[model samples]
Target chain A: MSGTVLTRTALGAVGVALGLYGAWLTLSRQTTAQIVSTVQYLVGGVVLNDVLIAAAALVVGVLVTRGLPAVVRAPVVVGAVVLGSTTLLAVPVLLSYGRKPDNLTLLDRDFVGGWWVFAGVVVACVAVAVVVRVRRGAGGSEPA
Target chain B: MTSTLPTQLPGPTPEHFTSRLRSPAVAARVGLWLGLSFGVCFLTGLLSHYAQNTSQPIPFPTSPSWGYRVTQGLHVITGTAAVPLLLVKLWTVYPRLFERPPSLRVRQLLVTGLERVSILALVASSIFMLVSGLTNTASWYVWHFGFRAAHYGVAWVAIGSLLVHIAVKLPVIREALLGDVDDTHSHDRATAVDQGVMSRRALLRTTWLASGTAVVLTAGATVPWLRTVSVFGIRSGDGPQGIPVNRTARAAGLGDDELGDSWRLTVTNGDQSVSLSRADLAGMTQRTETLPIACVEGWSANGDWTGVRMSDVLALVGADPESDVTVSSIQQNGPYYTVNTLQKNFTGDDRTLLALRLNGKELDPDHGYPCRLIAPNRPGVLQTKWLGSIEVQA
Candidate 1:
C-alpha cells in the first residue's frame, strides 16, 4: 500500500477500537432498561432529524425559493435558516420545560422576547442585504 | 436474490438535489469548523469527566481558579456552535444519500456499506449529543438514564465515527478544501445550477453567524460580560448571593433544624476528631477569597466567600498534610453529589474554605445556609453545600 493508504488504515483501526470501547462503556455502565431507552433516543434522534426535520426544511426551501426575485432569495434563505435554528436552540428555554416553581433563577429569562428580538434583527439584516443587492443591479450573483 | 432485485429505487436521486450551494466545497469548509468544534468539546469534556471522577489517578489541579470555568465554558460553547455547523454539513452532503455505489463488486459494496454505517453513527451521535446536552443545560430531564454517563459514552462513539469518516473521505475533503469555495467542478451533481438564491460563500457565512448567535444567546451563563444579551442563558446569575444556586436548600430537603444555630461541622481524622458549632467556626481565623463556582452544566459565577480555610480545619484535627478528605452534606438522604472527595491538593490549598458567608453576608438558606465548601478549580457540584462532616481519607 502507498503511504496514504497506510495512514488511512491505521486511523481506521484506531477509530474502530475507540468506537467499540465507547459502545462497551454504554452497554456495561447502564442497566438493560436504560440501555434500551438510550438506544431508542439515539436512533430516534437520527430518524427525527433526517426523516422529519430535514424533509420539512427542504420542502420549505423549495416552496420559499419558488417565484422569488433573484436579488432577495439569498437573504430570505439565510434569514429563514438563522431564524429557524436559533428558535430551535431556544425552544427548551422558551417552553421553560425545566423551570422550577421554587427556583426562580433557573430558566428565568424572557426567552420569547429574546427570540423575537433575534428574529427582528435577522429580518432587518436580511432586508438590508436584499436592498443592497437590488441597488447594486440585477445579476449580482457573483460568488463571494 | 441480487439478480432478481431491481437496481434502483423510486425516490429522489443525486440529481434531485439541484441546489448549487450544496457542493463538496461548502461541505468541506463547514465540516472543517464542525470537526474543530467537536474536537474542542471532546477534549474539554474529557477534562470535565476526569475532574469529576470519584477516584483520581492524578489529582485535579487547584490553581488558576478559572481553569474549570474556561474548559467547561468552551465545552458548552463549542457544542452549541456545532448545532448550526452540523445542520449545514448535513445539508451539503444530503445528496450523497441518493448516490449509488460505483460498482456492484463485493469489495466496492463492502466499502460503501462501511462508509454508510460510520456516517449513521456520526450523525446519530452528533444529534443526540447536541440535543441531550442542550436539554441537560436547561435542567430538562426528559430521559430516565443518567445524563453524564450516556453523554460521555455517546461522545466516544461520535468522535470515533467522526475519525473513521474523515479517514474514508480524506481524498475528497482534501480536494474540496484545497480549491476555492465556488469551484464546484466535479463535486457538484450534474443537475446542480446557479439559481442565484444563495452562493456557497453566503451559506458558509450564514452558518458561522448562526453558530455565533447561538453561542452569544446561551453563553451568558458562563461569560459574565455577555449576561445581558445572553437572554436565553439558563442561569441569569440571579440567586441569594448574586450567584445562581444549582440545588436549593429546599430542593435538597434541608429544614431549619438541620441548619439551626446548634449545627456543628465535625472534622475527623481516624482516632482524632473535632466539632465546631456555627459560632465556634465564626470565632476561628477567617479568610476571604474570591472564587468562581463553575458548574458542569456550564454556568458559573464568582463570589466573595469568607470562612476558615479547609487547611486550618484539617490542621485542627491533626490530619496528615497529604491526606484527601471526603466532604459530606447534611442531606444524607439526598440524591447524587451529596458526598464528594476533596483531594489533598484542594485540602492543602489555603484558598479552599468551608465558607460561612457570601458577599460579606451570612449564607442564604438556599445557598448552603450556615456553611459550604468553596474551593478553586472544582466543579460547583463538588462544592458540597450544607456541610455536615469531613473525614480524612487514610
Candidate 2:
C-alpha cells in the first residue's frame, strides 16, 4: 500500500476506536435519562448544522447572489451569516436571562437588548453596503 | 465543463448537484482554517485537562496568573470560530457525500466505504464538540451527563478523525493550495465554474470575515476590553470584584451559620494536624496578590486576594513542601464536594493563598465566605470554595 493510504487507514481506525470508546464511556457512566438526552443533543446538533444552518446558508447564498447586484451580494450575505450565528449563540442566554435563583451574578446581563443592538449594527452595515453599491454602479470596486 | 477526461476512467459519470463554490480549491482553503482552529482548541483543551488532573508527574506551572485564563479562553474562542469555518468547509464538500464509486470491485468498494465512514465520523464528532462546547461556555446544561468527561472523550475522536481526513486529502489540498485559488484544474470538470455575483475570492474573504466576527462577538468573556463589543458574550465581568460566581454557598447548601464565627481551617500531615479559627488565621502574616479566578465555564476576573500564604500554612503544620496537599471543601455532600489535590509547586508557591478577602472587602458568601483556596494557574472549580481542611497526601 502507498504511504498515504496506510497512514489514512491507520488514522481512520484510531478515530473509529476512540469514538466507540467515548460512546461506551458516555453510555456506561451516565444514567439512562442522561444517555437519552446525550443522544438527543448529538442528533439535534447534526440536524441543526446539516439541515437547518446549511440549508439556510444555501438558500440565502443563492437568493441574494441571484437577486442582488454583484457589488452588494458578498457583504450582505457575510453580514447576515455573522448576524445569524451571533444570534444563535445568544439564544440560550436570552431565553434564560435573569433566571439564576442562587446568584443573580450569572446571566445577569440584558442579553435581549444586547442581541437587538447587535442586529441593528448588522442591518446598518448591510444598508451601508447597499447604498455604496448602488451609488458606485453595478460592478464598481469589489467589496473589501 | 468537460464531462469525460483521461482521469475519468471507464464508467458512467455520477450525477449530483454541482456548484462552482463547492470546488476542491475552496474545500482545501477553508479546510486549512478549520483544521487550525480545531488543533488549537484540542491542544489547549489538553493543557486544561492536564492542569486539572489529580495525578501529576510533573507539577503544572504556578506563575503567570493568567496562564489558564488565556489557554481556556483560546480553547473556547478557537472552537467558536470553527463554527462558521466548519459550515463553509462542509458546504464546499457536501456533494462528495452523494458521489458514487466508478466500479463495484472489492478495492473500489472498500476504499469508498472507508472514506465515507471516516468523513461521517469527522463531521459528526466535530458537530458534537462544537455544539456541546458552546452549551458548556453558556453554562446551559441541556444534557445530564458529565460535561468534562464526554467533552474530553469526544475531543480525541474529533482529532483522530481529523487526522485521517487530512491524510486522505493531503494530495488534493497540496495541489489546490499550490497555485492561484482560481486555478482551473482537472478536478474542475466535476464543478461548473460560475463567475457569479460573488467571485471565488470574494467568497473566501467573506468566509474569513464571518469566522473573525464569530470570535469577536463571543470572546468578551475572556478578552476584557471587548466586553462592550462582544454583545453575545456570556459573562460581562460584572460581579463582586468584577468576577462571576458559578455556584453560591447557599446553593452549595452551606448556610450563614456554617460559615459563621465557628468555622475553622484544618491542615494535616500524617500524625500532625492543626486547626485554626478565623481570628487565628487573621492574626497570621497576610499576603496579597492580584490574580484572576478563571473558571472552566469561561469567565474570569482579576481580584486582590488577601490571606495567609499556602506555603506558610503547609510549613506551620510541618507538611513536606515537596508533597501533594488535598484541599477539602465544606460543600462535602455535593459532586464538587470532592477534594482538590495541590501538587508540590502549588504547595510551595508563596502566592497561593487560603483567601479571606477580595478587593479589600470580606469574600461574599457566594465567593466562598469563610475561606477559599486560591492558587495561581488553577481553574476556579478546583480552587475549592468554602474551605474545610487540607491534608498532605502520602
Interface CA RMSD of each prediction in angstroms? 1.3, 2.5
Q: Which one wins on TM-score?
A: 1
The alpha-carbon lDDT assigned to residue B22 of candidate 2 equals 75
lDDT of 1 by residue, B161-202 (tens): 988998888888988998888885767778888554767777
lDDT against true structure, model 2:
0.79
After superposition, which runs of candidate 1 have C-alpha atoms over 4 Å from their true positions?
B1-7, B194-196
Residue B110's lDDT in candidate 1:
89
lDDT of 1 by residue, A1-144 (tens): 499898888888888888888899888899888888789889998888788878988887877678686667777888888888878877778888898877887887888988888888988998888888777885464722
How many Å off is the CA of A128 in candidate 2? 1.4
Docking quality level of the chain pair in candidate 2: acceptable
Model 2 C-alpha lDDT per residue in residues B1-394, reported as the tens digit of each score: 2322323655333234445777888889989999999999999998998898888787789878789988888888998899888888887776565566656667877988887877777887788888788877777777766787778877776887788787778778888988678776646654456655565787788788878888887788878998888877778888876678888777789996789998988889888989988888888999999988888767788899999888888888787666688888888576743577888888888889989999999998888878888889998779888889999998
Q: For candidate 2 chain B, which ten residues in a row score worst on lDDT?
A: B1-10
Clashes (N, CA, C under 3 Å) per candidate: 0, 0
The Cα local distance difference test for each model comes to: 0.86, 0.79
The per-model DockQ list reads 0.71, 0.47
Q: Which ten residues in a row have the lowest lDDT in candidate 2 chain A?
A: A90-99
